[model samples]
Target: MIQVTPSIAIDESELEESFVRASGPGGQHVNKVSSAVQLKFDIRRSPSLPNDVAVRLMKLAGSRLTQDGVIVIVAQAQRSQKRNREEARERLLELIRAAAVRPQTRRPTKPTKASKERRLVSKDKRASIKAGRSKPGAD
Candidate 1:
């Protein structure tokens, strides 16, 4: 079981991993080895995540998410397959951890009287500078 949070623990079976060739300038060895890891997690069908969290996770996924509600994360920075696999899992865990947190709602705020005054003062100063740039006024 993969523990994401105190309340959320995902089963190993829930994750699907596939290995593919890592594309780049790595010469002949790179052509022979499939070091890249592709990690897929189905958010909509997950039993471990709450509905709200699942929704957020899908939104957070953005382009990484497929039409079927599966998140695909590719990790290929490492040359070793094991390292790439670990990186992919770490990234998924990070995403899950981020999705688990509740966002604080912003409260409506009124500008302070002092701040308002300061804004007006700055506006007046700018106006004066512009006014000074003009030619002498007609008598």
Candidate 2:
């Protein structure tokens, strides 16, 4: 089981991982060994996530989420399969944890009266300066 938050825990079975050969930096070993880990988790189908969290997760996943609502995380920074696998799992947990937090509601506010007055005052000052710069008889 993977614990994302205090209230949210996902079962190990919920995560699916596949291994593929990584393309860079390992020289001859890179072609021979499958060091990259592809981790997939279905946001829509997961029984472990709350509806609100799942919705937020989908939004947060963005391009990472497939058409079928599966989030695909590919980890290839590490040369070893185990390191890459762990990195993928950690990333998934971080994403789920981020989705668990509810966003603060934005409170709309009008500009202060003093601020509006200041803005109008500044505009008038600028207009006067420009007016003073023009030829006196050219009005």
Candidate 3:
């Protein structure tokens, strides 16, 4: 089980992991070993997460999320498969932990009287500057 927060714990069975050959800087070893880890979690079907957290997780996933609501995180920076796997799991846990927090709602506010007056004053100042640029009463 992965403990995301005090209230949220995800079962290990909920995650799916696959390994693929890593690309980039490693010489011959990179071609032979499957070091990249692709971690998948089904946010839509998970019983562990609350509805609100699940919704936020889907939104936070952005491009990595599939149409089926599965979030796919790819970790390949490490050369060892174990490290890559751990990295992927850590990322997923962090994402879930972030989603667990309730977002603060924004309170709408009207412009302050001082701010409105300042805006009008600036506009009037600009108008006066432009007025000065006009030709002086037909010379």
Candidate 4:
């Protein structure tokens, strides 16, 4: 079982792992060994995640999520299949954990008087510099 939060634990069976040949580095072994791990998790089917978290996960997954609502993660950084598999699982957990929390809403704010003045001062300085760079007699 994979623990997402203090209360949330996902079954290992929920994750589907597949091995495939990894490109780059490993030369001869790259051709012979399937070291890359592809981890697929069906967010829509999983009862482990809350509906809100699943929705956020789907949006966070972007192109990684399929039409059927399965999230596909490919891990090929490691040379060994076991390491790649672990990496894939870790990545999925990280992605899920990130999506689990709702982001704080941004409060609309106007620039402070001093900050507005500073900005205008900077703009004036820039305009003056550009004005100074004008061709002779062109103003």
Root-mean-square deviation of Cα positions for candidate 4 versus the true structure, in angstroms? 3.8
Candidate 2 per-residue C-alpha lDDT over 36-112 given as tens digits, one digit per residue, 9 for 90 to 100: 99999998889999999999999999999999999999999999999999999999999999999999999999999
- Model 4 clash pairs are none
Indicate which candidate wins on lDDT. Answer: 2
TM-score winner between 1 and 2, please give it. 2
On a 0 to 100 scale, what is the lDDT of residue 1 in model 4? 88
Residue-wise C-alpha lDDT for candidate 3, range 1-139, written one tens digit per residue: 8888999999999999999999976789999999999999999889999999999999989999999999999999988999999999999999988889999999999999999999999999999999889999955
lDDT of 1 by residue, 1-139 (tens): 9999998999999999999999865678799999999999999888889999999899889999999999999999888899999999999999999999999999999999999999999999999998888889832
Model 2 spans > 4 angstroms off: none
For candidate 4, lDDT tens digit of each residue in 1-139? 8998876679999999999999977989999999999999999999999999999999999999999999999999889999999999999999899888988999999999999999999999999999999999995
Compute each candidate's TM-score over C-alphas.
0.83, 0.93, 0.89, 0.76
| Candidate-wise lDDT, in order | 0.93, 0.96, 0.93, 0.93
Residue 85 shift from truth in candidate 3, angstroms:
0.6
Q: Each prediction's Cα RMSD?
A: 2.3, 1.2, 1.9, 3.8
Weakest lDDT window of 10 consecutive positions for candidate 4: 1-10
Clashes of each: 0, 0, 0, 0
How big is the positional error of residue 139 in model 2, measured in Å on the Cα after superposition?
A: 2.4
